[model samples]
Target: MRVWPLLPCLSALFSAPVSAEADDASGITVTAPRLERSLEREPAALTRLEGRALAPARSGRNLGEVLEAVPGIAVTNRHNFAQGVRLSSRGFGARSAFGIRGLRLHLDGLPLTLPDGQSQVDTVDLDSVVATEVRRGPASVPYGNAAGGVVDLRTAEGFTGPDGARLALQGGSHGLRKAHLRVADADEAGAWHLAAGDLSQTGHRDQSRVDKRLARFSTTRLLAGGRELRIIAGAMDTPFAEDPGGLTRAQWEADRGAADPDAVTLDAGQRADQQDAGVIWRDPASLPGEIRARLFASRRDFEQQLPFVFPGAENRVGYQRAFHGLRLAYGDDRRWGGVPVTALVGLDADRQADDRVRFVVDEQRRVQEQTVDERQTATAAGLFARAGFGLGAASEVTLGLRLDRLRLAVDDRHAGSVDDSGSRTFTEPSGGLGITRQWGEQTLYANATTAFESPTFVELADPDGGGGMNPDLEPQRAVNREVGARGPLGDAARWELALYSVRVRNELIPFERAGRDFYENAGSTRREGVEAGLDWAPAAGWSLRAALTAADYRFVDFEDREGNDYGGNELPGLARWRGELVARRDLGPGGLALAARYQGRRFADNANEVRVGPRTVADLRAHWRRGGWRLFAAVENVADVDYPANIRVNNDAGYYFEPAPGRALRVGLAIPLR
Candidate 1:
């Protein structure tokens, strides 16, 4: 693979000479449960980015762009807002057609993933985030089912910023325009933050236009008895975001900027209005251990038009969702038999209700008929506990266990049709065991974990075009074993490396049928990979970061729907080699950053027939600050490299490629509103 040749060079870079600086590793702490300790004490593969480390990514608008520096992860589908961002951790979420699956997402300690094992990133405002922490590998024991990985976003406290409002405006290529307003203030007893923004863009591809509005508010109140109360709310409205759809290789070669003809013909696109709110209460000194509780609720009204036109009907799907959840947790730190021990216990319960409807559209895009209607409900609950026991001054053993139960029910309401109403229940147990040993200023860790991912409601949608779940669909499960080490290379450098192997059964896969997405399960699969990263401050005002991932993912035993054996075939929608390099230098009151991303060639289908070639793209960003005023500029695809942002696996029509945007430029200014 392409990444192998770069390993030697990367090794040399980490060991290169540098000046002395304070060790940042000792001060870093992990916030999430099951791993809440100093970075040097944790027994997992974790990555944390914040403050100066996140400045280079702040120029981009999506999480995919913000997380590019993290290894063992692949992020794409950036330009197409209708489809949202696609993220895959160790190839776990590679099959998603839109949104995120097989991973857990959290914002301010509130779950962003729905009860049915699906998540959307449109609801998250990256501009407001201050820290992003990612825990790689299967984490079912810490976060219940579908926990291939965990992504947590922590926002800045209202008191952290200046005690006044700020306004920012930006414009760029492809008719991009944006404006934002923020207000924040804090006193000894409380703090509040409010922000609003508007954005519009005429995309690079034909028929691809986007318009969106967003708002967020958060407040914290200090209570008596060492108690705290907090509230958070956010909303997003996208009136229209055109879906250009995927194109065939010939079509793409002719004009990468062209949209699929089918998409233009049907005016395919999506509209979404979503809002969510949460309240959290915490008490520390009043209890034997710290107690925390959170309640959250969200609603979304969404609709989408597909490119395909069946016999006498143009396809469209719409759904109204009501979701709510509650979480309660407690953490205690104490000593047992002269041995240091830490324990945590938590309960999570969530429910999702969706009113889904299928419609036939006319050439004018007006609803012509309603063919299907159903009310689907998913309720889930989990009880989890984890403990860490110090074996000695240099070693610690950690263990975690969780029990999860889920119930899915569909009530068909379509008149005069077969009442295909049915329900299914699942009960699963997940566990993890790990050991960590201190190695001077570095740490070495090894762990084994288990996870399961149930089919989402969208995945269960009858492939034959009906109102009930597909009887053949089943949950996918996996077991992962990993070992790794991380520590300071020198006074000015930090490095991490991890090696892991996973065995999976009933691996879910997606395919396209007449432009609509459907799901199926593969027999079994095997995955093994190496992930490594390095950060170095070679001199004053200069910093460099690099990450690489190399993996071989293949089917161990599998037969397609056509009875063709796909054993030993490589998985689709994943690159065997991925790497990134970023360098930043402070120039007086301004800073300049340059980045390059590399992806290796990979197959687009289970048969490994269609291939997407390897490509490297570069980007540049710069920012200057003076008092409360700031100026920023960014240039993406500086080399104008043409590549596909995503692929449709096993697409029957062979229209598998979704082209990414070419070179583009953006500039912005921020000024205090006070």
Candidate 2:
């Protein structure tokens, strides 16, 4: 594949020598673990992306632009809004059929991943985010539940920049149109920020269009005695997002922009409206040490029309969902026996309820007869504790443990239908141990961790097409061993490398039956991978960031329902090699950036019969500022490469490919409101 040749270039850059001027990020601290600590002492693989460097000249389209360069992760389904973007870490979330699964997402300390292990990022305001942190592998043991990895986003609190309002307008190819406005101010007592935006587009493929609007508000108050209070609220509305369902390879080869005929015929699409609010309170210096608490709630109204059609089966689904959560924690820093110690204890509780209904659709896509109606509920709680003890001034050891309980239940409400009410309960424990050693400016770390993931309500749906849960579905468990090192290279650059091996039991795998998605357990699976990254400031006004990941994921023991042995087969939908290169340059009042991403070949089925080819895509962005005005432009897919943006794994109907757009252009202007 073409991506192979770039590997040598990346290796040479990582090994190159540099000067002795200290990098600006050498003393950076991370807040991903709810603790403030230097990155050098952290015993895990973590990447922090600064929004200031990423958001200024970008097309405010999706999260892929913000996260694609991070190593050990994959982002796909970029052109489809109805299904949202698919994010996978170390092959953990590769089997997700719809929303995000097997990973935890948080925005401003509030959990975006529901108790049912489903997440949607449509509500996140990318323009307002200030930073993002991603933790890979089993290091996410403290968060509990489907935490194959963790993504945390922190937005601007409106107090840093000048007190002013800015208005932005953008227009581009494919009938794209967008408008955004942001206002912020601060005083001695508090600070406030408000933002609103609207976007509409005519996509590259037939039957693919999207219209969306978003609004957000945030405020912070300075309380007495070193205490603080923060409040946040956001709303999102998508009038319609058409789904141009996956197409067969032959169809794609014939016409890359062709949509699935079934999708067009069935008018497959989705509509969603959501609102969320949250509050956080913190006491930095209390009698019992530092204390923090958070409360959040959200409501969503969603409806969708699928391309699936069957007698006595539903193809139109609608749901009203309510989700809420609360978290509390306490941390203390003390010295015992002349050694420094830091400890934290926390509790997390969350609940989700859905009132769902489904109906059979006619040729015109109108609902005909009701087929299923049910109320689903999921509750999850966890208690966790972590401690770190300083072995010496240059070394530390950390230990963490968490116990979690999850309950899922469904109540059949359909009249004159067979009752399929059922419930499932799971209790699991996760733990991690780690040690870090510092040698001058370099640090070495090793960790062993355990994690468990219970089946979500959607994943537990019976394969027999019933209304209740699957009786045989069980939670998946994983154990990971990892070693890594990170430090400065000649003071002008920073580098990190990690090697990890993971073993999974009862691994969850997805399949399609009669046009509907279902999940089953693989007897065993193994994943081993290496990730490397580099950041260098070669000269003033110039910077480069590069990352590469190579993973080998396979089934150790697995047999299908038809008794087909998948053992020794490579897991589908994940590539063995992925890499990204980004370069940025400053020109006084203007800046420019270029990014190229490469994805290696992968499989579209568990049997490894269908192979997806590799491709490399590049994007260019530039911005110029004068006085109080700024103009920006972006060119996506600069090389006009044709590639499969997403691959639907193990599809029985031979529908697997979703082609990405060739080339697109966008230009925008930002005006300061006096």
Candidate 3:
């Protein structure tokens, strides 16, 4: 398939590196800089897994699985291909189904969630990611609301070499198979660059399959007068299996582990397709100050089959979202009256729409139940300012403030459905203050911040009476405080420790009412915890890393209308303690490596009713390099253990979702054409 091409104007912008610093010809220094530099300057409270650490240890399916070892992070795998990971810090508890509360997800600076604040992250394939930056605590103010934290993903810009191509094909147990390929080139002028690739995999579980294809093209141009322009275009198509229900423990034991409890036969399929394009401009000479502007647009369409037993009861749910956003930022660094100060200001606006539909298969596929022909719109406008000052020879203080305005409107029309329309406007104010003290190679820091999250459409939609909607729900809010220290130990080791607490109000809860789950607001709760991690390179070719996170969370002063004191219960899906350990040893000459990893057991539901057992898995990887050619092979799940990564709560009818494949192997190769 032909994907959208990068815009010629943008392709010309990134051809050469542009100085990110501002000019001071006007006797005033403007420290304008690139977004990349801004991110690097910020302190990262969370652990980062990069390079070899990411390649061999990334087992399961999604980005969440790869990050499970991070301190205070838990991943719930609903299926081998679908996963939900949550991150908690110090005493703060994150939603089990979605990782961290007040967490922000970004793709190249663009938010990845629906305007309603819910992320449709299943579309993200791990193989295409270049890097993931995790920011812990409420210090993520610059990204807008939910600054509770942020995960930012960037794709490969393009191959810098003359030309290159790589292809990988493999088959394993459970009818599993996959193929991946990449091709890239840079024009002779070195001003034009292009890259494209595809990834396809047929899964291992019964009736579980996946076929995905993706292509990305980026170009850069060096403009005259010390400016640059860049453009990027990409598209992705993914079709995968879906298992929505779980089995009971009784049935699980009776089945003798031979039958897949999370199995089902359905008539419809599930899929998601997306196309995106973006442009960026950096003008280092405009007004003697560094200035950067970015704009992007993306269209995503998604569909899923309704889980039902009747032959013709299965329905299709789908939506199309178009998102557009723009950002303008300025920064400056200069000494005033013998004191150094750096400041930045930025503004952004984003808009999105959701369209829903249903389908039927009678001899031929056709539109049947238009159960929800709804159009929802959400717009967010925000302004952020941050200033950092040198407190002394070895200490610095940073202060940041952000103001956001969010507006949402929903219009729904289903057959005999109540045609209800409602709109709400919310103004969220959040900020953070931090102090960092550096001594030799050690850095100690303390910070405090506030964050908030608005309710989603799914939370507001009433499942009763033909799926009515709630109009009076309030947004969830949180205040987070944390203190930590990080530094290098000796020449080849690093360690970090953090303690945190969060108080949340108007928490959203899904209640079981008449066999269907509905949404409501829980009174209030408090969460506190500690997280610590260490990475050590004991030898030139060996590395070891470990992390531990523990949290204590409870409902406080919470009362229902009936005055029921349902407090002090362990919040659902909240793990009291979670940890991971990994060790890697490099084998010289052939680029070979051996790896082992272990993770603790985790609860399956918020009520803490069920628990998935702990897991210890091993992996081996070997790579060969000859000139510009490289070949690699990997063996995963060395123990071949069967464990559940996630469980469905509403599946009271007896269905259980098993983990993933066991003892799988793969190999691939890459070659550069010059």
Candidate 4:
């Protein structure tokens, strides 16, 4: 509360200041542009967060808790470990109920998102991550199949200076226990790193506990002729992660920690195991250009129980999936017509096959019926090229183009239904143009791009017990335009701000009927938003970070089957305003940190009924270090705010709210060995 006065004074002084020379540090060099370009000059809306900023919220078992304040990004549902984090960038992924959609996730340069535009971040080794980069706005031209956003989680390569190791232990409220170990060394074998960890929590809500274990290994080896090779591998096992489901308004008011009756009755939960490995090869320096190629493969086995049951059908489902992919890229630093140019060309391709089954549960909990037997396959391929050209000294223009083709297929083996097999393919050519001009430490930018997204096979399925795909289902498409400016705010602060709008056609919407969920395409939709972020190091021992967002997402033209003319209404899942602020004060050997977050009230369905959100929560953490050991503690929801944190839109009943956790505490220790 004391930080409020600084805002007015800081603005007034800035608006009425004399001209001065800017002293600013440049942004980091990142691969978010696929060009290994410098963030300060790159003509895109990109942001990067270092690992040191994520340590405070690492034990929450929800990624949203860790990445809460990133600009143009929204991460919520901190208490729902079962369905994973609900993350969105600029309203792109707001409709997702579970897992991640409309975004791409990459770990150690390997794609975690499948070819069908579906992804989950639970397998990421958060304890071992060193950095993360977010690419915002329409991205079809650079990454195929996702129009929302892209997140890249990078891990530590190794220690080039000396050998070191770290051991960490954690204990928290709600029966939380976590431990992690990491080691890095450099010797005659080049450089290598190893990390392993396990964590469990009997969550704040009933029937929502989770147990998970993970391991990661990475190494880089010098090859003959000055070439190099890098390898990365990961393994994960999650024995149990219960799902409490959603609660109605009355139910939420009665008890915020109680599980949904249906979820408790069915014992809803999931278990999963996953493993993946990747290899990267670099060409010799003598080659015409810098050439790098990658190969990767992954396997996942999973099972889950639904909250409801159909008498003759199944409520339990299982999945086994195999995935493989490759990426090849070439970049050249040269001049075209006496102007500096950085041009990159790349190819991406991936294939995935999933085998699924469903089993009925009778009174005795036996497999009474074999209701579903099917295999789904998806393939994607893309070719893209981008070039940046320097215009004069402090201005540049960039252009890029990508051609992508994706195919989805389903092979139904259900004996009770006729052959419901089907296949669909789509090809799209997308591109973007960007311009940036710099004046001292200030940079001005503008971008115009096109985006496309084909529905996942499951989203195209009819909810009326029909096994075949809906013939009328179609892909969603959009165009985005944005402009923004970023620069230093004196020597104590930095700011990045942007405003944009997007127009979309055939926007997908979800609906539930008789316990089955299905999707429909709206005629048109519009989204307009503004995003702002600031990092202020007011003094030597004090640091502050703030972010504010306001967006208006509305349906332009559409009507449901019941002749309901709903032409103008706010989108179901997006809130109009959101804000977050974090501050830290160092006390030599120890530090105190505080964070506050706010979300405005928003609708729970297309009809603008059942509003949720509009809550503010504060969190605090303190830590001290001496020698190679450190101890820390954290308290979340310091004010014990009561609010619905999640909404399951368009449900059969008026059960959309998911209560958030109240006050909780955690304490841990970290020891480093050298």
Candidate 5:
């Protein structure tokens, strides 16, 4: 084990007294107010990594891998082929497992989770992500049904420029390699823009690999006075690998710390393809008021294959989901009865369907047996309203509310009958209130919110073959209380701190019976945590960033139907503390950056029966930029450390877990023409 000095590197990078104006060439914008808006609207705590922060580190094929330094977030590398990244908000479920129990994910203002409340966000392309907005606690309500928080991803908007293209290639450790190409064009009239790209990677792990391609086109037209219409269409194809499951403590020690076990060689594969199109109309009728309406549709096909050791035991399953929705919104920044107010209101609707099939693999590498097929459909509609008012010269208050109705139905294909086909309507209500006071450059705020999440069709399905749904299951509800502050330290430094507590009732927890897993609502639980972050550009060509988050979670009066008391047990998948530190400086022409990250030890089981060891990883990145061309490279897991980001333990069998990638290097170059 080795420990490195943290101060020398930071001080050396920022010893020079550099003015903020001189760093404008790096594309780091100082929009304090815009940044504050993100903080105020987000529930818990957040960090924005964009512009140069992403450009040099965009070596990996997955966005999750590139963002591992963000506090309280971890990336679960399922294999070289399939990478499932999980975000731990303080100490919550990983991998979106708990149905976003304490977190929510949104892409381009649309919910990616299925109608069943189950969401697997494995398809987003990092190249297309322009910004990511994170909210830590259950404070996020605009998107609906999220008790944790929300992560909103904004994709790149088309540019109005001449035709241009970019090409990037990278190579790294563990047979890691990558290539990327992007092309874009804007019509002379600036009314149309088109962008397309393809990205692929050969992973460091034995079974890990990835291939993805994407395309997007958008156009805008000027309508009658002060009105414009825009349309966008996009598509993506991605395929990745899934390696064998993780091992238990006994197996790990027996194998002398090696990941290889029976050599049974069970390889999993996944293919995801999607297409989306949307249209938007905007009218700016007044200097301070605007109206916008949008309609969108998307179709996604997801397939997974589990090829096991036993002959004919291979299973190929897939699901198809289609979504369509419309939204109308009005916003105004004006004075209402001598009080300044910012108001917004909107309506939204969504329809989704899921189909799954299980197939067997034969000796001839063909699919032979077909076992089960199931289909489910869900529909939901909602209305949202938000208002912010200035209480005085330095104080402000905000209020928000949302109402939703959801219905679900399931049908079995093989039985030739609608085994569990029933529609139940649920009206979910959510609201939040916040008050902010400004002192000099810092803003102090406190808020409370109420949020609800309805059970998905999968969660409500009867495991006993009752041919009926569970009408007794109630929606999970949460009350979040938070207080925080944000401000600038001089002109070149920024910092934020937030403390939050969440109390949840009727939380859904997974239970195992007869080798099968099902969901049940536990009693009550509570989580409290503090999240703090800092960013400083203390000198020219240098930057220092760090974040630390700690959480305490426990079941409060929690029990199952069997009268098992889970109270006093640490919440599953919750880590008590996590943090990261980075120091980067310009090395004249070609620059070099170094980062050190530490992940605290955590429990692998909900019962807090097993503990995973802590890990420290160091990374180095170097790059050069000239004109429209840039070359970059990075080394991850420099010490070749081995660890598991997620683990699932079963007493009789062993551990089924996801491992992190070993030491690997990636090098690539980007060329842009304008």
Candidate 6:
């Protein structure tokens, strides 16, 4: 198979290091400079998770299963792998129907987000992730568009010890199964880590089945001039991932586990193959100022079948995607007017292209009509600079500015009646100012920033039977303000609290009619919230952690094209209040844990009529380890409650419910090879 040959070669290139030493790994520390800095120096709300700690969530079939208790972030899907996990952070990406939008994702410092601000989490192997870092808020200065926040996933550097391998196998209710492997080694010359996995699931819901395989390799090398080079490669292939569409209230009540009838009739689903690679070369200590450069690229082949057949309008779609980009950044320390100051400057550019076509497929999955053919592209470029100066012994102030330009173009090749070919561009400026004050172990901070989001080609090609970009569509923009504090509580506890408010212009919203999706501007919206997190250890080997988020996200001014007003309504898809509590006790080479996750009532549609929250779910996990062997067991939804895992906001016919599974059990074993 192409994957087998590809893995070992990539592993050999990265693992052939001269000599090195192994370091003990700790909690999630990220590569994003904006987040790597200490909490005392940052003004944004952020959360980090060590992959090893995400046993319950990561044990499942999708990445959404890996995000369990992070506050201000929501993840859910209808157990349909093809549609991917629908994720939203602080009410930013809740309207998405397929794929993730309104947020940014970076893997090992490489661009996972395309130039047009669309991204998917399906290709990255969660089993291989070492850490997860999420920054929740407006952030346009560090990254470009769709920076409603950032989710940076970090992979292992090299072999943990001299050289070793680990394997994990799991099986559970609903025909869930998974197998994963990790191998690594390092030396003075360089270091490398390789991981691979295969997962298959017979979902609880009818017509929900999935099969996925993935591989990842990372390597780094040292040069004589104190220079460094790191390379990363990954691949994913999915042979089958069925989509079970949403259900109406009556249908959901009748059979919570049934797939949408239309989806079953048309055999709706998708198959995909993705490959990506990235490299970073830099020298920070060799010169007075640090210099760095990065290059990355990716290719994907995909085919999808929707529920309807429009004949000339095309129902089945296939596309080939290619993307690549480069970046240059420099940073240094200097003294100005007898005061210390640090400055940073960088330039980034990227482009993405797609060869897309549409076909009408018969019941046997045979293509009958070739209704559409076209090439689509999106490009973006940006320049940015930042400065931070010491104000006093315990105070600091910082400023940053970024300028960006984005362009989208499409070429019609179907020879259809309409030209369906044109180009559009947007130039915007963004910046932020922040102040931080430190007192003993406590710190207080304030900040304000501007951000924006450009529509992706998927959005432009609205599946609501449209062939060209919606000329009425416009970019969404926002300004955010925030204040926060973080500090230690006595000698056994720690806490963090943040308050924020954001006002947006031209917020993009989705609507459904006749079984197709359409989008429009919401005119304006206001979002204000509070985030609190606490971790307490009162005694040796025992710990307690909790997080809470409360927000008022509502439309300040909104109306559909039909002149129906939708002003002053709570946001659909996100609860007004959410919280989580987890407790753990460490045993001899093992641990036991219990947790509860809760959410307040949430609207299921734009009209704020259908509510789907005010729900709570409990889970438990226990594990034992000795030497190089370990065993673990977990129970999810311990009480067997009926609840919605996700909602299809504003779906026509009120088909807004995607039910969650009842009580389930999972067990796994881990073994080591030397």
Number of the top candidate by lDDT?
2
TM-score (C-alpha, index-matched) for candidate 1:
0.95
Q: Write the per-residue lDDT of candidate 5 for residues 187-291, one digit (tens) a residue.
A: 544455455555554544334456766766667676666787778787878865444445566655554224433222435567788998888788886445778
lDDT (10s digit) by residue, model 6, range 239-272: 9888777888888899989988767877888899
- lDDT of candidate 3 over 339-417, digit per residue (tens): 7777778897888877766554333345454555778888988888887776655556778888889888777665543
TM-score of each: 0.95, 0.95, 0.84, 0.94, 0.85, 0.92
Candidate 2 per-residue lDDT, tens place, 1-674, comes to 12323334433332333334323236678778666677876788888988444547766678877785788989999889988889999888889888688889999889899987888999988877878899999644578988898999887788887689999999998888999899999999989999899999988899889999999999999988889999999999999999998989899988889888878988888999999999999998676679999999999999998866666556788999999999999988899899898888999999999999888897777778987788999999999998889875667898999999999999988884567689999989999998877666677777889988888887898987565689888999999877777888996788898888889999999998877788999999998888999888899989888999988899999998889999999999999999998899989999998989999999999999999989999999899999889999999999999898889888989999989998999999999999
lDDT of 4 by residue, 432-537 (tens): 9987776677777777888888887668776655557776778888888877778778888778987777878888778877565678888998888878888889
Q: Could you give the candidate ranking by TM-score, starting with the highest? A: 2, 1, 4, 6, 5, 3
Give candidate 6's error at residue 221 in angstroms. 1.3
Cα error, residue 548 of model 1, in Å, equals 0.4
Error of 3 at 652 (Å): 5.6
Model 4, 594: alpha-carbon shift in Å? 0.4
> How much lDDT does each candidate structure score?
0.85, 0.86, 0.59, 0.81, 0.62, 0.79
True lDDT of residue 258, candidate 2: 87
Residue 551 local lDDT, model 6: 86
Q: Over the full model, what C-alpha lDDT does candidate 5 score relative to the true structure? A: 0.62
Candidate 3: Cα lDDT at 52: 55
- Candidate 4 positional error at 369, Å: 1.2
